[model samples]
Target: MSIHVVLYEPEIPANTGNIARTCAGTHSHLHLIHPLGFSTDDRMLKRAGCDYWPNVQIEHHDRFSDIPEKYPNAVFYFIETIGEKNVYDFDYSNPDADYFFVFGKETTGLPSELTDQFKEQCFRIPQTDLVRSLNLSNTAAIVVYEALRQQAFAPIAIKEAAD
Candidate 1:
């Protein structure tokens, strides 16, 4: 199965870097949506990611809708603060179809319009108490592992899936 980690307008390069490293280690595809806060050449991200940035398989998308064109067979799963379905409840392991795990900007989360437009596409990562949400990279790490666990941690399936 193929997995795509989509970050919607991520603000912090370090967070993105860490997420990229996680994606590299897990062998998941990383997608960074447009209007990023920092440049791809940011020193902080470079430091946080070290040399792992090149190891990760990443794609850049100008818009969320562009994703479907790139992976027509994939399912888009957006993560947000308020979601009808708890992330834990969703079946990440289903191998019948490809999946894309979408996340929003760290500061304001996702745009309401996008969330409302894709209401059925939204999902939540379970949290407790006063915390609003987890760090972007951390959240990505958690969700990616769950997906990996479900897919038996397949080895770089993107190349084959795109074929």
Candidate 2:
């Protein structure tokens, strides 16, 4: 019933922190696959999350394969530059199942070996050569919001319960 954002071998602490903040705001879970470039307890990371750490549901894993083992039925969408389809191409209408959006590290994106296994599920955010790729946090936000939008923007507590 929730979305999961996976950062594969993330190299930057601030990016992860900012992503964590976004996840907290959207009620999504943040998954970090090691080995991270910076320690999770880093001060800069803490500063970037800006006191929202308590609100974010974070998980750590030693390997990416561990995620599939944990959630075998989870739907994964790999985010990489080589993906033939953009985010808008997919139908994320299933709100009952957990959607896992896998984003590569800030440096070198997800390995081709991994993407090859799930090429159909891979997606990219359109951009020009103005930069190598969009920022990690920015990309995550874009994909998550699109998925949420496709789902009618429901199931995320659009309104609080009335007494």
Candidate 3:
């Protein structure tokens, strides 16, 4: 019944801070994959986060593989430009599931090694060809909120499944 927001090798501090704030508000756990561009205690990060850091459930990992190993039962959904599925295609309301939405670095989307291994799990927000991609913080908000929206009705879904 937990939702996780994974930031893979994230760069911008403000963006990470903003995403952290969103994670706090949604009650989602935040996972940061290392080789980060800035220190976690950066002034910009602290400022953008504005004390919400105290409320966020956060974890740090040296590698992305570490996460799957630690939470083997969790379902991972990677967000990439080359993904086959749209954001709305999946059902996030499964009561027994723990979900992780993985977002990549701002400058270079996700690593091919990851995208290749988890191609089926990758997803996109569905945009026109005119834009390369949306802002990192904004994209994180979109996917996280969508997951929350679906989970909001989990009681009905659970009841239906129990029938």
Candidate 4:
């Protein structure tokens, strides 16, 4: 099973689109929890995803609670700026496991109720107090890539250049 990227109440179409492109490149599934800040047909979103939109596997959800019912066997990790553990602390190398990386909206972030419930699985990409947080798309990319890297970048063929 592949990794899944879940965006809860994402507010920026462009960020979502960029994350979609990253998900496409990594072969990760994307789940969007409504209400979204923009329409799926938004031009900016389309432009950001570009030709990779078709390659991205996307799903929509009405609420955060709907996800567990859908992917019953999947293990979820809530991503936030103030998580208790670092992203690298998790062992994502289990080939048989399916992981879901849940991110919040561009502005308010994941609801306290949700994050608190999943406190054990909460992870953060370490950053200094110099800034409030990184951009949404950038954070997604960083976390997804870290997970991919831990898994040896499986399902994403990597070839070395010819000597």
Q: Pick the candidate with the highest lDDT.
A: 4
Pairs of colliding residues, candidate 2: none
- Best of the two (1, 3) by TM-score: 3
After the best TM-score superposition of candidate 3, give how far the Cα of residue 96 lies from its true spot, in angstroms: 0.9
Q: Compare candidates 1 and 4 on TM-score and give the better one.
A: 4
lDDT of 2 by residue, 10-115 (tens): 9987788889888988888999999999876757555664688878899999999999999998999999998999999988898678999999989899988889
Ranking of candidates on TM-score, top first = 4, 2, 3, 1
User: Which of 3 and 4 is ahead in lDDT?
Assistant: 4
Q: Sorted on lDDT, highest at the top, how do the candidates line up? A: 4, 2, 3, 1
Error of 3 at 55 (Å): 0.9
TM-score of each: 0.86, 0.91, 0.89, 0.93
Count steric clashes of candidate 2: 0
Model 1 is weakest, by summed lDDT over 10 consecutive residues, at 154-163
Residue range 71-101, candidate 1, lDDT tens digits: 8889877888788886777777777777899
**How would you encode candidate 4's per-residue C-alpha lDDT over 89-108 as one tens digit per residue?**
99988888889999998899
TM-score result, candidate 4: 0.93
- Write out the backbone clash pairs for model 3: none
Which candidate do you rate higher for lDDT, 1 or 2? 2
lDDT of 4 at 144: 90
